[model samples]
Target: MARDRLHEMRGRVAIVGAAESDEVGRLPGKSALMLHAEAAHNALADAGLGAKDVDAVLSTGRQTANDVPEYLGIRPRYLDNTQMGGCSFIAHLQHALCIVEAGVAEVVLITHGESGASRVGMGGGDRFAPDTPPGQFEMPFGIGGPPTRYALAQARHMHEYGTTREQVAEVAVSTRKWAQRNPRALMRDPITVDDVLSSRAIAWPIHLLDCCVVTDGGGALVVTSADRAKDLRRKPVWVLGTGEATCHSIISQMPRFHVWDAAVMAGERAWAMSGAKPSDVDLAMLYDAFTIVPILALEALGFCKPGEGGAFVANGRTAPGGALPMNTNGGGLSYTHTGMYGMFLLVEAVRQLRGECGERQVAGAKTAVCHGTGGILSASATAILSTER
Candidate 1:
């Protein structure tokens, strides 16, 4: 008989600190970077560590996001401006470990910010025009805005899977139930699955409620060696494993519209590296920009049999007292949807593992999994964390 694998990291690379600014529905004076810096300061303070102790900074490049190290006034031995989309923050976790292993940095900082509620668009033009390497397939077709692009993806999902209007609504209803218990959520009243089905469709198979709300918010995290985390003021949530992968971005030319292969690729890598399995994770903080994204991701991530996700998340399986407690912070659906909602998932995951969540907390949550999808299923990332450290 095979023996259970020991907690893979045994408490190695740990998240010593994490934070996010208040979910501002609207903030006039706070620039995007200022909010980011504020979160960074809070995280550093939570860890009982100083800015000077940070040896590297990981910035999530946004239309107007700030640099983590530059704004903090630190000269780290390592620096990474990794801007890969919503999943970039999780990607930064993976990148920071490599940097630390290479002896380039001892402590790392990751920060993300955006003012989407203010209609703040980056790239210095009418839309997101990333001209440096050139946004090969993103900018030209007006396939740029998240809502419009998600509409296209949702349409394809229904076409291929026989996915119903009611089933998609279930995702929102279930998450909203959890959101009602969260004080940080921006939209919380109580929505039934029928309410979602009745809402006006933004596009076919894409209702107004199906889309995520845009807000101006930012989040940050401080990572250090297991040795450092144990010495810090707070408990350490070990980064057992992480992975990132991308598919072709050319929407018209994508291989298949029905599946999310990136999530599979990244999920398998993260699980293997951590020596953990789907059953090992007690909770999941899935990136839910649209109702349909998580349904597809459940299959792609191997949480359920392909094509059975509709039933998996049905029957209150993802509700408060769920078999697998999910999106306890309301997620992008009810919480906040900055340009990159993915970073917020990580912040919430760390908080859950630390048992810091008050009402919506998952009981005895020893392990957590964070999944982020970027650029309309163009890229994906995964991270497994535990509180053993």
Candidate 2:
């Protein structure tokens, strides 16, 4: 008989803890470093382990890897600062698995915090200064921040797929339905397609409600060997599969606007590693920097065929009590988004797999697929997690 190839890192490591900072909404008083420390402390406590037990650290945003260790008062044997925009933590999980599986680190902590709303201690001045590259070219042509830049791609999708404004607005409305159940959600009042359509337009096709909220928050995760995780205080969310890929840095340079090819490649690798199909996923924590993001990701991830994403999510299929409950914490759209929304994706996935979500919880969510999109659809990372080994 022919020998079978091995999935070396599958189910080798598990997330022992996942938590957000003390507060997720606007907190002008808290600095970026403070959020990191608070989230780290909370995650460690969740794992029933202290900072002293951590041998590796991963972080993003203004906080560097070395900065986090010193601030948290831990001396990590290994460290990573893989800041590929928001999806950095997903990539961190992949690296942490390798580190733990190789016996290099017993415990790994990945942290993320950003003062996105208050802009406290953040980089000074406008991100797209007229003197900068994008400013010199894109700005002069009326191209602005992410909403405007990403709108170009969303507009393209509408043209090619015959996707209507109502189809795109459905994403925002359905996601809000989930948000209404979450007490921590920022904009959980509830919204409708008409409300979304009438709302002020940030860009042509992108409305204010269609975009993710800007908030001040942080999140952290604790990863260790699956064996060690089994003995922890909480159920371990196994890292069944992980994949990452990068496309273009700037939105203008992207090869395609309608579909994110990187997500297709990354999601394929993750599903292949887990040996599971899209139907196997109980929940999906897709990055919603904008409504179009998850729509395209759904197609790229094989949840639906390309150009069919509009129909896939039209009637609240991804909303609460639907076929697939997604972003039960309300997601970046209704939940808190501190610039890099990637880490929160993993946090919610872990919580769901642990059976901790109260009202918005999927009835029996055992598996989740968390995906992140960084930059202007430049980078992507996909992770498949499950409760069972």
Q: Which one is best on lDDT? A: 2
Cα deviation in Å at residue 359, candidate 1? 1.0
Q: Give the per-residue lDDT of model 1 (tens digit) for 214-321.
A: 888888899988766667898888889887888855455446777888888888778878877878888898999998888878888789877777778987788899
Over the full model, what C-alpha lDDT does candidate 1 score relative to the true structure? Answer: 0.79
Candidate 1 TM-score versus the reference? 0.91
Using TM-score as the measure, which candidate wins? 2
The 10 consecutive residues of candidate 2 with the worst lDDT sum are 1-10
Query: TM-score per candidate, in order?
Result: 0.91, 0.96
Candidates' C-alpha lDDT: 0.79, 0.89
- Among all windows of 10 consecutive residues in model 1, the one with the lowest summed lDDT is 1-10
